[model samples]
Target: MTMTDQRRKEEGTLASLFEAERQYAPVPSGDWMARMEALALEEQPAPRPAVPAAPAPRRRSGWREALRAFGGWPAVAGLAAACATGVWIGIASPETMTTLMSSDSSSLLSALDPASGFDYAMLGL
Candidate 1:
């Protein structure tokens, strides 16, 4: 049908539904409250018996507990990477350590500058 006919039909159906709903008067407040109280009483759990305390959880190994107590795998990977970097700088290349330590601030800045075309691999650091 046309849009206007469809709209009129929908409005009529909605009004009839609302009228049907309105015809049923609500339960009295006193009756409803009493029913709700009765239902609540019926649904209450019976008292549970007191039981012995649960056994203590098994203790994990010191390192395993420490790992979990701290951040887990991501923290571990970060620490591993930092240690590896430290070891590489300390033992693998003494020259790199000296160069980094001896270099002035300006040279450090130049190394960081992308426009200067600073090649880290070429520096052999």
Candidate 2:
């Protein structure tokens, strides 16, 4: 756009007015600055506390510890089966169980032990 001479003069006048206003701009007083600072602090969001990272998984104790002590799940299942059998026998009072319980322990050991006849000394370990 072509600027007329009048418009150029108006532009100069406007620039000078802006420069004068900038030069004569009032400095904020200390109280005003302090109040502004306080308002800024109020308006601005507070810094959030850092979120704690998720805690490490805790080691379990009690029943889980006892379960490990019993040689894990398979062993525990075997033990539970044995206990159930014992309870069943005690409650039912089976005839064969009574006979087995009454038999001599030495005779039972020899009967149950397949290695009874083997002479261990012959191995010369």
Candidate 3:
């Protein structure tokens, strides 16, 4: 009665007619299926080759060779003397020693006199 029902009925009638005329027999096969499968397998590419590993390099003995070439004991003594010279110059310099000596208690007490109302009790001296 409705347009959709009429359309569905028409479709079913057409489908049944087509089914009545259709073949129900199995299709005959050829060697084409086997050939196609063989061709597909043949067309597949082969895997790539693996890369070769490199050899490990030799260890160095250059540091020992250099120390032997320079005469190791003399080289060590020269380095120690250079370090001692630097320390001696740092400690023996007049300006550095004067600054160190001026930081002593006697210098601090001389800077503040007893008659100058300087609070020694506050300094805990």
Best by TM-score: 1
Q: How do the predictions measure up, each by TM-score?
A: 0.36, 0.32, 0.24
User: So what's the TM-score on candidate 2?
Assistant: 0.32
Per-residue CA lDDT of model 1 for 35-107, tens digit only, reads 9999999999999999999999998899998899769989999999999999987777776546866899767
Model 2, 16-52: lDDT tens digits are 6766687899999999999999999999998999998
* Model 1 residue 2 distance off true place after TM-score fit, in angstroms: 99
Model 3, total clashes: 0
- Residue lDDT tens for model 3, 21-109: 56564554678778888999999999889889888877669987777887898997898899999999887885745675678876655
Which has the higher lDDT value, candidate number 1 or candidate number 3? Answer: 1
Clashing pairs in 3: none
- Model 1 RMSD vs true structure: 14.4
Worst 10 residues of 2 by lDDT: 116-125
Which of candidates 1 and 2 is the stronger one according to TM-score?
1
User: For all candidates, what are the clash counts?
Assistant: 0, 0, 0
Candidate ranking (TM-score, best to worst): 1, 2, 3
lDDT of 3: 0.73
